[model samples]
Target: MNELIRLVYASKAAFRAVPVTQGVEPSVARILMQSRRNNSQVNIGGVLYFGDGYFFQALEGDRKVVNQAYQRIAADPRHREVTILSLKTVPDRLFADWSMKYVPVEQAVRAFVRDRGYLRFEPLQFQEEEAEALIKLFHQQRSGEAPDIEKKSGWFGLRALLPRKFGGSAGR
Candidate 1:
């Protein structure tokens, strides 16, 4: 039986910033292309968000396939400090219409981040509530609604605020 599941992960981009050509970074564009091809082939669906040298992605598919895909991603050298934020069985796919939807952070979301006390888009410092909010924001964006970034007063890399036993590092 095909056990559907959802796996969310975050990682830091290992490569230096390259100027975005045509509104998409060359490296990120390449990743998106590859993801679309591979994911479509395997019947996987998901969304990917990139900003400020970090990646936040949610992949949904069969249990085995999703695990295999996560393993493959963990092995990828392009990502560092790969972390699995959430992994759970689900009754249906949230992004069934997309093979691999790539959602860019909108200005509103950037502002939202600022409002949330995060000066930049660093996924490493995201708390569980923050992660869930981001996921919901991405879903809203996918649904054609504009997502807003919360503006708070704080900087990034404040690991002390993180959960003691939150998501575990996956790829290391």
Candidate 2:
């Protein structure tokens, strides 16, 4: 049986400038469009969050494919200090429907985090459970669903919801 892997990473954006208009930065939009096309071809699924010169991404798919994609991303000069927070085998994919879901630092989400005592969308400071919850929050928001932040068990509880297959340690 083929094993699936989920890899999460945090990085500092090489470019910190924001667009003058109300939309995604042109460069980021281009990247997202290209990534969506490429990832779909390879069966990759993931979510990307960008805010305050930082980037937090969670990628899930076949082990080898995900690793290769990570390598390409690491080589991209747009990202600095790229660090993998977690890379472990899982029984299922979390962002299965999205090839590359992009979440920018919007006022609503910023307010949500601030209300929760978070200064920013910094996934590096989050535990595994918190990170999962954040991803679920973005997913819910994108789907136009009213997210219940108090219900932290939404996606974080997947570990308990499904059986584990491969026993592998998370990467640094």
Candidate 3:
């Protein structure tokens, strides 16, 4: 029997800004493809979103393998900062193994920041449409449901609001 568990792992990861400037998008793509390939061997489904020099990925699989992969990703210098928002285990499968994904934040979402207003997205209050879409995606593993995730906030990194002296900064 294929044992499955659902997880809504919310992660905030910031990458080295230099790589993006150096036209490292190809390398990043390569890394993503390779990660997905390797994951297939271990029965894992990894999906990710990117924007503002950061990445947020959701993965589901065997507990041991998933845990190890998470450790590796956290250690990867390409993305030094990682803040896991929530980790919950569900009774059913949330994703199909061997499935990996990506979404351009802007293209995948509806609302964007305007004039630095905090009125864009709220935290943990995904509207009915978004909530339904998310549950669908989680249950089916592939349903154009994103920018929805962007609607929720509270995604503060412990190291994003302060200076290096404060150990909380997301800028260079």
The candidate that wins on lDDT is 1
Q: What's the true lDDT of residue 159 in model 1?
A: 29
RMSD of each: 16.4, 13.1, 16.9
lDDT of 3 by residue, 52-98 (tens): 55555666776667777778777776665465544446465455533
User: Which runs of model 2 end up more than 4 angstroms from their true locations?
Assistant: 143-172
lDDT against true structure, model 1: 0.77
Worst 10 residues of 1 by lDDT: 146-155
Candidate maximizing TM-score? 1
Cα lDDT tens digits, model 2, 19-110, are 54566777677778888889988989788877777778889999999999999998899988888887788888877767887775477668
Residue 153 displacement (Å), model 2: 32
Q: Per-residue lDDT of 37-119 in model 1, one digit per residue for the tens?
A: 89878989788888878889999999999899889988999989998877778888877767777786667569768989987
What are the models' TM-scores? 0.76, 0.73, 0.55
In candidate 1, stretches whose alpha carbon ends up further than 4 angstroms from where it belongs are 142-172
